[model samples]
Target: IGIFMWVSSTEASWQDFRKPCIAVVDAKTPTTRIIRAVSVVLLPFLVGFLGYNSMKPSTDEPIELRTVHPAPPASTKVHGKTFVLQTASNPYRVDDSGKYSDKVQNDYKDGNPWDEKAPQFLQYVREGGQIFFQNCHFCHGDNLNGRGMFAFAFNPIPANFTDAGTIAQLQETFVFWRVSKGGIGLPREGFPWASVMPPWEQHLTIDEIWKVILFEYWHTGYYPRTWD
Candidate 1:
């Protein structure tokens, strides 16, 4: 299949080329012979040194010294309102009694979000789900497990909510702060601004942010730890 125009004079200058090679090996003087011997000995060493250095591992990528979940600032300003992380709460996480308390939200855990008579908690969760699918789900995932289609596209990747080390360990207020401010609002510990999580306060209302937190907790069935 290799179509090449080959001439019949295959031996045309093959002998002529060998004449130079014979001259090198035809070392009549001791200095010439010594040079030939040294070349032979140094050639393999030079090749080996080059190959070893070329195959060595490179330290090209910069090391990341960022803190994923650095301690949140005690208070953060969102939509021109300052919220103290320790005291802030998700106002939408309420039951029929209209307030979040011990196991009250669990009553509406199986409630139907589509029903007109659906409990307030479920309705808020539904609204949050809508907002999440519209804006947040691309990176946070449909299941909120941080496996969304565009999850790994970011440097640190999205948070896996199903993991105990993430949402389960943090307070809802902390999540509120994070949602409202996003990665850009993170303290100096989250250096280099590698996180692409957009500050939601710019795009969503504070209530919408709270509802999203409710939906996340409800979907994962993980109670957000309280500072108390």
Candidate 2:
């Protein structure tokens, strides 16, 4: 009777539970359905997000914040007839007459003993030419004709040293003064323009200045007579 009951129960359970459907559904159909669902859900978001980023306008980053404080106004005072200052970049102009004092011109003279001999003068010219070529050639032409490469860029243009009249009129002391003090200390009517001629007095020895003076004189045919 027990064996019979057990068999009946087993049969009941088997009838209640159907066998698993092992019959393979078309794999392509389910795969396509899953792929379609994922595509439908994800494609619009991916495309829209990428498109939005691409369409957004570019913006510059903010500049660094800063504070600026300008320097105080410069002080001025007259010393004797001229003004002295902490910064010599621009000296005080004395008169409105556009003339600098002779005191300033006298300041440039070195009082070197002049040699009259041609060989000595020639030697001075050669040395002066070398120095001028090394230092001044960038602004003054190689032949001293004032056609240097830098002359083109100058607003007032460099003086034409080759002009006989101009060369003859220029004093050696005047040349030395211009070289020593530069355009800043020059009379308003003299240089009358800005320049890059540095204060060569600090860099060149007194003898070198005389040599350059002699060289310029010789180059412009003022030498032998002017050397002394």
Candidate 3:
């Protein structure tokens, strides 16, 4: 009777110990629940900040923004040559001014006349140089030496303006005429050779043409002696 009683008591004790263990397993609680929740909330924002920093544009720390001023007007007094001052917006009309006409007879067959003013001549040179760079630099080159970027592909290469002998031989009127009319066989001439010269009469005024001419003349060392 004593042995039966001891066995029943032992079995009851074991049952009592197992009950708490089973309850614990059923609860299924994580140890770091609070930490995990905080991490999940902040992770997206942290990742986005890092990505934005990587993609940010670089700064130009040392350089400052600058404002450019418009260039002053150019003037010249080459006796037979007329210099007109007009903007690109108000181009001269061929009908209103005899400067540009389709009539071959109106072409500047005579060369430019010599002027005697130094100050006016210098101003013309400065203005002409700027115009040449803006319009003719792509094909005529910055030095007016004719080896422009596109000169190689051209069948008849652009004329070298720096060649003193050549400049001496060429008349000012011829230069103006060529610039006004452009090449004949190339694309400019509406032919197969592909001259790239655009007709400036539509875009540039007669005064602008004169300015360019003055610049070319001064570039070749022909400074004017008078201003009037």
Candidate 4:
């Protein structure tokens, strides 16, 4: 009880001692007096500035929470042709049955793509593989998982088709627009960005582009989402 009283009394004495007394301030020089006056006026603004900076979000964080499949335009033009995204479909996403065949697509994943007897869909997949290996492998890697030989050179590297966020969630037509337009494909009015992806339209034909997309789905076993 005595110890508690002593500590309380001591703390009260310290608080009394710390109380500001205007007469106690030693502004002996003109400069010292000016500095004190300026500090009195500027301290609140300085504190406010620091507090605001501390509370605000950073401009660059390396991590971005972005829509992997952003809303695509209703109609997009590429290579002297316009594709209506809502109605468009992947022509190569078919087998000998004349439509998508789950069994055929699954079997081709393990089988040789370069074989002479490869089914029609598999044949397109083979050609797509050729295009990917020739152009995309350096950045997307041989596995089409985005870790290519040249992948290390880029800050973000290429898109990993294996990830559910990328190819799996996107429509084939949307994918087509991205490839054809590359970095310039992003919505112009929404935000500003500069992508390193080359617009494939300048180099590859529409047929080649479709074939590359076909190979990607076959290799990954992902079907593009259909527009309802």
Top lDDT prediction, candidate number: 1
TM-score-best of 3 and 4: 4
RMSD of each: 12.3, 22.1, 21.2, 8.4
Report how far residue 95 has shifted in candidate 1, in Å: 1.6
Clashing pairs in 2: none
Residues 178-205, candidate 1, lDDT per residue (tens digit)?
Answer: 8888887877745775677888999999
Q: Rate the local accuracy (lDDT) of all candidates.
A: 0.81, 0.52, 0.51, 0.78
Worst 10 residues of 2 by lDDT: 65-74
- Indicate whether candidate 2 or candidate 4 has the larger lDDT: 4
TM-score of each: 0.73, 0.43, 0.40, 0.68
Which candidate leads the pack in TM-score? 1
Off by over 4 Å in 1: 1-60
lDDT of 4 by residue, 19-86 (tens): 43332356666766776666776777899889999999888847644445556789888888999988
lDDT of 3 by residue, 191-216 (tens): 34334466665556667875786666
Q: In candidate 4, which residue ranges exceed 4 Å CA deviation?
A: 1-67, 97-104
On a 0 to 1 TM-score scale, where does candidate 1 land against the true structure? Answer: 0.73
lDDT of 3 at 189: 26
